[model samples]
Target: MIYDLIVLLRQNPTAEVCHKSIQFLFVMNVIALAAVQAMLILRVWYLFSDQKWIQYSMILCFVACNVLSLYFTIMASQNLKLLNGTIFDLGKHGCRASRPPNFYRMFMPSLGLHTMLYALTAIRALRNRQIFSHAPVLKRLIRDGGLFFFVVFATVTFTAVGSFLTQLPRINITVIYSNYLLSLTSIAMSRIMFSIHSLASNLGSSTEWLLSNVELSRVGWRKGRNENEIIVERRCAGPDDEDYYYDDHSVLDIGGGRDDDIELAHVDGVKVRRSYDTSRSKSPMPRLTESRVGVYDDLTW
Candidate 1:
């Protein structure tokens, strides 16, 4: 579209064409910028999941920034005209927006939004540092989030400076520069999201294993009267005592020891039980109902 606009401008320089081109540029630029903000807001929402107040505040900021951007874009579009008030000689390469009085107002909220998101990400990273210390994927996510924030913030600052420079008589290409910066912002935001998604996919199996280990470590278990049955107990008390213990029908023999039983074994610490001869008429093993006290409870890291 930009190439086509340049070609049209070079072929036929007209006020209507110039106005339409400027309007198109402003609309596209605003849409791209809004997409970038939405992506960042989504990341913040995911990072602070289930926190209603934080989510609401981020959403409110996003909405306010977009509203301000749209308002300023409309104001700029309304004020757009050919340079030097001459339609025929606007520019052979492209058109320029007639600087509006409050052109910078549109982008100020975006800067504020980026700053707020950056702070939120930093806080979240700090708070969860210990919990996710062993998970490199989450660490990379925080790092990438901060890097994207910096990139977008820098672009916004450059846009603001360009907006100011447009006041100078010699600097007439602020619109082009601002559009380019906004496009870059969109690309950077999208790339960040893609990288995070790719990393998550690569780490999905490990994450599942970690979560499973944590869950196993949280639950306590005891041997049932029947040798084949096991009693699983939740470490945390449930609503009622009756709901605390449940019979697990699966057969699990720890170590073939008469009294020894396994609780929550680490991924690499699990010992395989000795296989018995099912063909022989072997007597049933002694029922060991002893509670494995403090065995799995200590498994909680």
Candidate 2:
């Protein structure tokens, strides 16, 4: 029963069959357009999360393009089927519903929109290297937008251009296959872009982690230096004739171990001089001084 039904459908008159097919295809195309808009939504969120203006502009563009293009594409498709049935080769009863000029006008602007989207995606990816480095979300946005643009742009451009040129009597296979070639090129570019985005994201994450660790280490090291140089107070007895004298405190590192000379001298009832191990010495020896100015001294031998 199913085999017979399939055969019956295959043998149906072309014009009537195409009219029905167009109706289904048109709906499906609208659904696909909706999916494209969804991709744009995701892309805008990822690419312009920081820029309110860009995000709003993206929403506006999506609404405008989808509303306009879908209406035109459907209208043009219906008009093509009507024209095919009534005007062109009415006597011959096969599916003669071919491409229409109105379809091209409706379709061309959509293709242009897609191309702009792809270029925008690529530019956003290049510009937001910082986000790509810090998060995978932005990278995915770039990839999705780029891939969607490439697929739709190539599909529409190639189908329209190649089918029209193939009508030429002595055309090359390359011309006929130009659409396929463009599809392949777009696919290749999409893959390359995806790979680049992935690598860029990984590098971004690694760099951020490294910088954060370095900052933490620097903070720890600064605290450690403050601990190393500590001031302390100590009182020591000074030497005097039959008298116990005292000296003011001295600074020392709490963790450091050094020997100090206890000998001292007094001046004006205060211990003014002391000696310590050269390795632990903290004071400079006094020297006689004389002042001179405006001297440019040079020695040449």
Number of backbone-clashing residue pairs for each candidate, in the order shown: 0, 2
Winning model by TM-score: 1
lDDT of 1 at 131: 49
Summarize candidate 2's per-residue lDDT along 1-301 as a digit string, tens digits: 2332342345335566667665555545555555655554555555555678777776777677777767776776666534344566455433444454344444454566566667777788788777553344445556665765677667667544543553542332343222343345445555655654554343333323322423223221111123322122335465443253323432222222224344332222233233343443355632211111221112111
For model 2, the superposed segments whose C-alpha errors exceed 4 Å read 1-9, 14-17, 81-94, 143-148, 159-301
* Least well predicted 10-residue stretch by lDDT in candidate 1: 288-297
**C-alpha lDDT of all candidate models, in order:** 0.61, 0.47
Candidate 1 accuracy as lDDT: 0.61
| Clash count (model 1, backbone only) | 0
**What's the TM-score of every candidate structure?**
0.63, 0.45
Indicate the worst ten consecutive residues by lDDT in candidate 2: 288-297
